[model samples]
Target: MGIRSVLSKPLAKWVVERQREWMYRPAEAQQRWMQRLIKGGQNTVFGRDHRLTDVRTVEEFRQAVPVRDYEDLKPYIEQILNGDSDVLWKGKPLYLAKTSGTTSGTKYIPITRDSIPNHIDSARDALLNYIHETGNGAFLDGKLIFLSGSPELDQKAGIHVGRLSGIANHHVPGYLRTNQLPSYETNVIDDWETKLERIIDETIDQPMSLISGIPPWVQMYFDRIQERTGKKIKDVFPDFSVFVYGGVNFEPYRAKLFDSIGKRIDSIETYPASEGFIAFQDSQTEEGLLMLLDSGIFFEFIAADEYFSDNPRRLTIDEVELNKNYAVIINNNAGLWGYSIGDTVKFVSRDPYRLLVTGRIKHFISAFGEHVIGEEVEKALTDAMSKHPETEVVEFTVAPMVSPAEGLPYHEWLVEFATPPHNPAQFARDVDTRLTQLNVYYDDLITGSILQPLRLTSLPRGAFQQYMKSLGKLGGQNKVPRLSNDRKIADGLMGVVSGK
Candidate 1:
């Protein structure tokens, strides 16, 4: 046998064992999973969405549930302001998880006992697989760093993504975690500078064995760690064993972050969202084994290729077809049924149920894995530039690229501005400051060594006008692609940004 196959034979067996264990769970077998999620998700099920307590039968719960966006539940959210419990599901909501969603902008995703287990169980299964794969779980038992959000919401009506964030951290067993941002009890705005100052100050003296969070932000922390502590983040945590990451592609961030740290750390991939915790890597090498959370959710897989089709095929966890890129649709015990949360994943294996995140099936950019979509970027860019008035940006596109040389490729700005900033470097700084406030992920990517320096490429005004002329795409539904990994798609955007 070839050398590679010989090495992989044992791995293949383990992969099979793990996958088989997770996938074949029938509806009846998922009783415990359902109960845990139902109990934990008290807020999501019984509270905001109103699907839980009313749903005694699985089918009634499934059908009566209308798929909802953050806006759909906004009025109900306003009622939860005075620490009201009647409007929300059982008990006072344990807390809010601040997270970013498609249309809701940044929202405070409500989490209750009913909702938290979905995240906890999925995270645990994924962690379990990672431990078996790397055998580094022992070291992880030490001080583990999870680089998530501040987990607080401005007590406003709009959905704050950070709320979901705080709720996740709060629910995690304190014994396994290290320092996190502004506490669940606090009402910090999640301002990038404020949050970093707190995290940096808090963690400066401590040592960590494992670190996990969005790739972009972690890269930023590496720099902040160096600036404040004088020692490279790598030296500070010499025995850093695991690098658990989710949200964005690590390929772009890997070289610089590790090479600069001048060490090797096992990287673990994770898949969680505002909707629920999805899947994660089983091993550093193996494609992520999707640990099906049988209890928390009943999954429906829609064909990724045929996603928007008139008759797209959907397969449930029990009926998922093998080897297909399926857009995930979930029937969360918390009451989300066939809800399309806008992610596209390809199935690597079905017997045990594992999936690979291909590209964004949504209009999102994970440049830092904070899951910012086209709207957020467009809005933030607009809001930031509004004051300058020196440059009236006509059109723009933002994307993350892997460098041809090394490290995460720098973000290139294709902006069409009226009176463009004469100095490229200074303009880049202004843009960076604005984006950081909008999404910590983008801010961190720019600050970290993992990504290249930001550059501005001003385009002419007539550019976007002319391109739209040729493509025959007269703007019926011409949504911009926020995270363009494909070079060709990125190149095409230059015309609009540059007015070429």
Candidate 2:
């Protein structure tokens, strides 16, 4: 380990030790602020009539913040866009983080200056937890590859958050900014493809230790490395320590990432968004993710079993149930009083607030916890397909069947062709193998004969994207959604994938 690597643990210890200062200090002070924030959230987010603000104890924080769906936050989002600063954070949000939603349209979430440290802290917790879990303290010394929105700003506000990929160009630390794709405090990605290519080329030669970012783009760069170098990524950047991915599931494609790479490393889940970096994995060996920034943002949990119920109880951080899935609610500094990012997560513990991200409430397969997530399925499918000759896939989506056939509960896939030999049957077998290899539950269900076999289909060029574009969607914040809870989505995908 290098000098920095050896000091990685020390640096993390310093940060966590200082969390009290950045967040809250003194037990009484912490308790006082907690109560105040809870009351503030209940009255401001839940509405003035909510009885939650008056309730004491940590349970109040849980019960007051109802598990909200994304659609419920449109008006609040509009408030942020129009320059109203009355919601979550304390100061003027440094800049907005662009992202996409269930559909193709964009979502512009705010990131206040105070919240940036929280992101760093949450990320640091993840890094430190890895060190503790794997006994690899020098994990950060290796080249850290962050595949994020390009360093090109969309140049307009309210254009939706995903389009704001360029914002990171300015928000990133100054030391790294100079080595960045474009110069400081400036939004410039000279040529989208060329810039991405340059990033891949530059990153390929480095000692990439810890990789972090959105999984899709991570897979994109991995494919590029293989195509340009005529070898699997293991041959190029073999020293990868751990993959730190949030904003998506890593289960579907764990085969391609964990097993496909040359090194054996950990995969840490994070609960970061354009909105805020809320939670992270705290322990290296623990099954659930640790939440470091609970103080950065007030949290709430609603039992999945109670989602549609009239008296569904939304509990606070301390009242969260272990191992069972629940929808999350948040009141952060971004002016989103009580907002739900539409993600479904389950708490593993709360001593430090760790969680397991099950799936998106609206996006997951309700049938048999097929819980088909983007990161997992994406990595799985990509790894499976890469096993073939001279080929790599750019994108894919999985849609579950609405109508079951004779004890079969299959999920149909829509794959975008990257090369020839696109035989649907072979691809199906490949994908099925991936499901069994990477996803434990998927393998169990398949072995137990619970679900139907997976089906594969290729879409015509510009079919689903065109549909998105036609709807005035299609941007960074929004990806072409692959899985759906809505039954109608299957027919739409079937028609698009078949080019019918």
Top-scoring candidate (lDDT): 2
How many clashing residue pairs are found in candidate 2?
29
Q: What is the Cα root-mean-square deviation between model 1 and the actual structure? A: 14.4
Find the 10 residues in a row with the least total lDDT in model 2: 178-187
lDDT of 1 by residue, 1-500 (tens): 33332434454456547555546765444545545444544554233355555555545544555444457666655666545554534554444555545457655545556667778866755666665555444554445656555544344333233445455665675545433333443324334545666666666666566677765457666767777767766778776777777875555345447754668877778777766788777656556545555546666666765776766665556666665556777655444444676776766775556776654556555554555544345555555455454544445566666564655576666665535655657667766666667667766766765566555667675454445544543221122344554455457656445555
Total clashing pairs for each candidate: 34, 29
CA lDDT scores, all candidates in order: 0.57, 0.60
Give the per-residue lDDT of model 2 (tens digit) for 32-126.
54565555545343334346546787656546444454566666656556765544444345666766565635666776665566665565566
Stretches of candidate 2 off by over 4 Å are 1-3, 16-33, 36-72, 84-91, 103-105, 132-142, 154-169, 174-195, 258-260, 350-352, 365-396, 400-482, 485-500
TM-score of each: 0.59, 0.71
Q: Mind sharing the TM-score for model 2?
A: 0.71
CA-only RMSD, every prediction: 14.4, 6.4
Q: Largest TM-score belongs to which candidate?
A: 2
